[model samples]
Target: MKFPSLFSPLKVGPYQLQHRVVMAPLTRMRAEKPSLAPRPLNVEYYAQRATPGGLIIAEASPVVNTGFGSPGIPGIYSEQQIAGWRKVVDAVHAKGGIIFLQLWHVGRVSHSSFQPGGALPVAPSAVAISSEFKAMTAEGKVVEYETPRALETSEIPGVIDAYREGAKNALKAGFDGVEIHGANGYLIEQFLQSRSNLRTDQYGGSIENRVRFLMDVTKAVIEVWGANRVGVRLSPYGIANGSGEADPMPLYSHAIKSLDPLGLAYLHFIEPRSSGAGRAEVNHQNVPSAMVLYRPMWSGVLITAGGFTGETADAAIAAGHADAIAFGRIFISNPDLPRRLRRAYPITPYNRATFYGGEQKGYTDYPAHDEMAQA
Candidate 1:
């Protein structure tokens, strides 16, 4: 039997993973709302994809009500939500899979309908995103993005507190670790980019100020999960969710340098092409691939995500550029992706239409290769 590099076991933080293929955080929006809790449907969905001794970073979950941006999005601040996720954690653990919760807070990519008491969403600055965004309301109605209010200086610590509390809740919910969602134009990314962050305070001007919020949040989360079990996701040139920078390399290089000393679990980078067309075009002129840019800067475990095939992922691991390869869409269609890749099995095509806001049709209906072979 020929062993692929991707099938090799590696240590990520405190856990020793069986393989280097990680299930990236994906939002399916299947959780029940009002409480925004995970249901049996979610339990079934994650359990189906659980690979023994592999790592799975669960979907992005809101940390606060004001940070809610979509319908059926789970939260970690509520007891009911904690109880709901316990089922998921237990289910994954039962299958011998390690799962981490991705903590999220959408800033300007939100509508008032999803906010608390219809208050405007808060961001690093009052700058409204020029790009259009769709947000699901509390009533399940989709609405356009609204102009967000700038977060007051006095309110910054409270925002950090929310992340701390969310991390604590994740621990109570039985998650092995936590991944802070700092990528893709969310609250932390909003602060990182100059186009969206127009504030003149200590949290705004230089790249140091831009990275302050993320650093603060990481520290707070580390207080709960510690540096070993904590991870961070970053999209340096990402223009999604209405945020971008004139030059992302410098900002990201500095950001990576700042984060390198923390001794965190892993630093996950969403490749430029994965961020969307707008960001790709902007970065095409000067930026190199994420691995090329960050490989030397970071010494710890590094994971890269985008469009990757089994061959490409194996080559990446063999080349020593990435410690692990995270798959999003591929994992959606192929539940036993690691086994499939190891044997070079045929992959099932996924339906993009049923990707979100659906029941078990596209969520949990995808069968494993063994099951398909049996049929």
Candidate 2:
């Protein structure tokens, strides 16, 4: 009997995964405000997708108490928040699935109203990201993305501590592991890019210095959750929301080298195209395979996301380029994505209109093949 490539069992971190397929962390801002807790709808949403060989990393969770960037985005900074996620963890586990929380901080991708005491969004330098999002106000809604305040050299430890606390919260919430969100031009990525992070201090001059914040956060998170239970996501060549890097390879290589000693679960790379035209939407386009080239250099598992299909994903695993493949948008519409892939079933395209800030229209309404047939 020829073993199915995608269905092959693989040991990742401390978990013995049933398959090499992973549900990449995709944001659906359904968590309620004040508590920023995952709703019951989220519980039903993830539980439906849980299956053996399936690894689901929950959406971006704010690490610091100060970061309240997205209106309905969840946070792991408080006890109430941790309790909320516990419910989610329990639901996913009931279906015999493993889950990890993706720890995040949006830095300048935030507005002043979202920060603690209405503080300005913080970044490596005072530079604001060349992107904009809706901001809430008392009187009425307004178009505002004030320039972010720069993190003073002395205050960097607090930011790192926030990630450590988030890791502790994940463990308390009963998560199998935690994935650090260091991609898509967010806070961590903002520091890595030379264009966005222009400072005379040690944190901005050289590639090693720029990657220090990310490395520090990774180390701190691993300390809270054992090395094997921690994973990180990166977008080396990703140019999203007007973020541009002079040279992505050298900075990311140095970052990986710094993380090699940590022995984390896996190093998940976004595999962005050099031209930046195809950023997160993965399809027929192929990355240069540069990030995977350095996989052997690291001590832990390696997972590649962005535009992966059955054949390509199988080939990547077979070739030792990646231990697993993470499917982002695909999992939204196809709850039984793994089964569908194995049986060669037709995929249900996701509705873009209901992707964000909706009740349940496009959130959990998408059905599996069996449900489709019954209907």
Clashing pairs in 2: 19-53, 282-307
| CA shift of 220, model 1, Å | 0.4
lDDT of 1: 0.87
lDDT to native, each model:
0.87, 0.80
lDDT of 1 by residue, 1-375 (tens): 544489899999989999988999988878886788999999998998888899999999988888877777888889999999999999999999999999999998777887768889999988777646565566768666677899999999999999999999999999999999999889999999998898899999999999999999999999999999999999877667776789998899989999999999999988876775322223244445788678999999999887788999999888888989999888988988888888999988877777777788988989998788799
* Cα lDDT tens digits for candidate 2, 231-274: 98887766665566776668888888888888888888876752
Q: Which 10-residue span in candidate 1 carries the lowest summed lDDT?
A: 277-286
CA RMSD per model (angstroms): 2.7, 2.9
The TM-scores, one per candidate, come to 0.95, 0.92
Q: Which stretches of candidate 2 lie over 4 Å from their true place?
A: 1-4, 131-144, 273-287
Best by lDDT: 1
The candidate maximizing TM-score is 1
